[model samples]
Target: MKRTVLLLVLLMAAGTASAQVPSPSQPPTPPPMPTPRGEVLYSCPGGIDFASTFSNDGELATLRMPGQPDIELSRAPSGSGFAYSDSYYELRGRGREATLTAAGRSMRCHAAGRPGEPPRTYAGGTLTVTLFPDGTFRLRDRREGAAEPVLDVGQWAQEVEGGVRMVLRGIDNSRRAFRELSVDKLVADDGTELRRTEKTDPIDGKFRLAGMYRDAQDGGLFTACLVGRTYGVAPGGAEPELEKAWVEATPSREASLYVEIIGGFDNNNSITVDRFLTLKRDGACPALVFRGSALRDTEWRLVELDGTRPTFTEWRRRPLMRLDDAGRFTASTGCNTLAGDFVLDPDGLRFVPGPMTLMACPPTEAEIEKSFVEALTAVRTAQISGTTLDLIDATGKRRMRLEARGR
Candidate 1:
């Protein structure tokens, strides 16, 4: 009886479990898949193409293309595609085309070809073009079959006067030719005639110079001069001659005076006055200043006892270096560079020589350097009264005085 009861209980439990379980063939149906969003297709005629899909949150989830490997650009919210082509291309909801042209080449973009659908074409030729979003565009051409250069229209010369007395010369490959084309005659505000003698030649035809003229009514006289085969126009017959004279007569002012030391000093280091020299304006022949140097107690004095003569051995012929209103001075001191500044004072003039790099020179050159430094250093004040410059030291001693040549 106990065994029978246990078997009965087990059978009842198995029957209840089997009744509650559902069959595998009758499972529940799944939810429908979400529709794709965002840009489905973007492409250009020159093989650039792209496609994209978005997630439920409107975020880009996938991007696909042909030829190029697929890329997952969804790190951030992504919904755009990029492609590279010879020319620019873009596609939105509807199909559109953009074309560009330059030189002898043309590029076109069109709707991508599909089964049973004709592909749209955007063709560009020698003309250059720019397309905008509002369906408007700009076109330009240089040569007849090429795109025009991106030059400012203001830079182009245009015909002003009616076809009268104007000449047109065309240039092609650096060769000049005459043409019967319209020429722009530029004129100044004062009614002065301005001529543009340069032009480019037409591609398909031989060029010729065009000449046009108008009646003169109080017009400026125009004279033409022919030298060999070249002709030039001037305002008057004597204009060219006057221009030449003015160019030749322009005065060139000298900036500084160059003084060179010549002759040898005596064994006692006494330099005689007769050996000194001065450079003239001719810049070729040096004038010998007979009394050039005088011997003072220990140092050779640049001035003689008579005080009117400068003593030196010899000086190279050079033009006097000129100075402007400013007191800054620059000059070549025979064998080396010399520069300094000068200040005018009531008593005398002061000269401050900038430091100079020393170089090896002959014995006479060394003496000249020493003397030049001493003369410059001893100046307490300097005055450019008239054409003469008088330098006086602090001890009331007259160091040197220079007179302007030809003054």
Candidate 2:
């Protein structure tokens, strides 16, 4: 009887404890992050934005900005967010969307998709070489209807004589058959030979080959359809120098880009191969500009200060100004460089000028630099109309004018 009574008491206690104990509280659900598929528009902190297409497989991506080349991205390190790459350019993810950071801007975007074929998706697994008679070559992944070459020689090695040598180490997925290429002889089928001169030997001298679109300068910008060349001049010869040639470029600067091919003698392999030369000439416009919006990441050149434009004499390059979406603004006076911060709001724009870099330049360039900084301090408002960007002061007068390049 006592044992029965004790068992009943224990059962009653157990029921009482159960009644007092609290059930586990469920955790709150996070807001749903956007699906990483389809067309997504990303905005940078500077109010500048761009659009791109993300593949449904959730890895491949394609940038779809007009006037810009489509950048293809493969998968990156995993997260609830995803990242994709090609090194200098990349895409990352955060809270509700991912970010594509290109040319130094981190733009956040919301992604969505459809059941259609991915615009950036391409058939991989083939390799091809694009060689010109001038001996300049490009390495590309053979794809169906690829608008751009996968790999150009400039992306890897220094343009040298006999061409540059590169090795593919451990990447198995790379375009196969990329190895040392042995060129027996350079033929004239592709214009490998430059005009022979009495004083210059094709292999050891300099030539001024003209190109299209002479470099230009607006305010502080060096604008040009400038082409960069590298020649493997006799490896150990005194460094090469630039000299005037029978080439001149203006209006359609095509004549400015003259291909000067030379034959390189390799002491290591006892092989003679052809190489090319690069040119540096004084022109106008520099291609590097601030991109995006005016109050955003757009670069500005001071084409005119107040009511007039300054004329440059020695170096036709103009003072350049590039402002990124990050509110960071940089200015060059054709000599020294200056930078500062800018703020944008519904009330308009304002500049919080910063320090200038200290460097000695020619008297003319120094004077131009001083003028550029002085003009920047007067900026209070700004606007973008078509391809023209203008800066106005607090008194509502135009302070500077710039033409947007490569927009």
Q: What are the candidates' C-alpha RMSDs?
A: 45.4, 29.2
Among all windows of 10 consecutive residues in model 2, the one with the lowest summed lDDT is 218-227
lDDT of 2 by residue, 233-325 (tens): 233232122122213422232223322333332433111223334443443222211122223333345678777887776433577666554
What is candidate 1's lDDT per residue for 1-407, written digit by digit as tens?
A: 32233234223323201122333332122122123343333222232223444444543334333212223333232122222222221211211222222222322222111211211111123323222121112223345644534211000001111111211111221211122122233333234443332332112211121111111223211110000000121233333343333234323321111211122112331211222133222221121111111000001112221144534455431212222225554433444445556554233345676645344545655555666667677867543322244556676666565533210
Deviation from native of the Cα of residue 88 in model 2, angstroms: 29
Off by over 4 Å in 1: 1-314, 317-323, 345-348, 383-387
TM-score of 2: 0.30
Give lDDT: candidate 2, residue 256.
Answer: 32
TM-score of each: 0.23, 0.30
Worst 10 residues of 1 by lDDT: 222-231
What is residue 83's positional error in candidate 2, in angstroms?
A: 26
Indicate which candidate wins on lDDT: 2
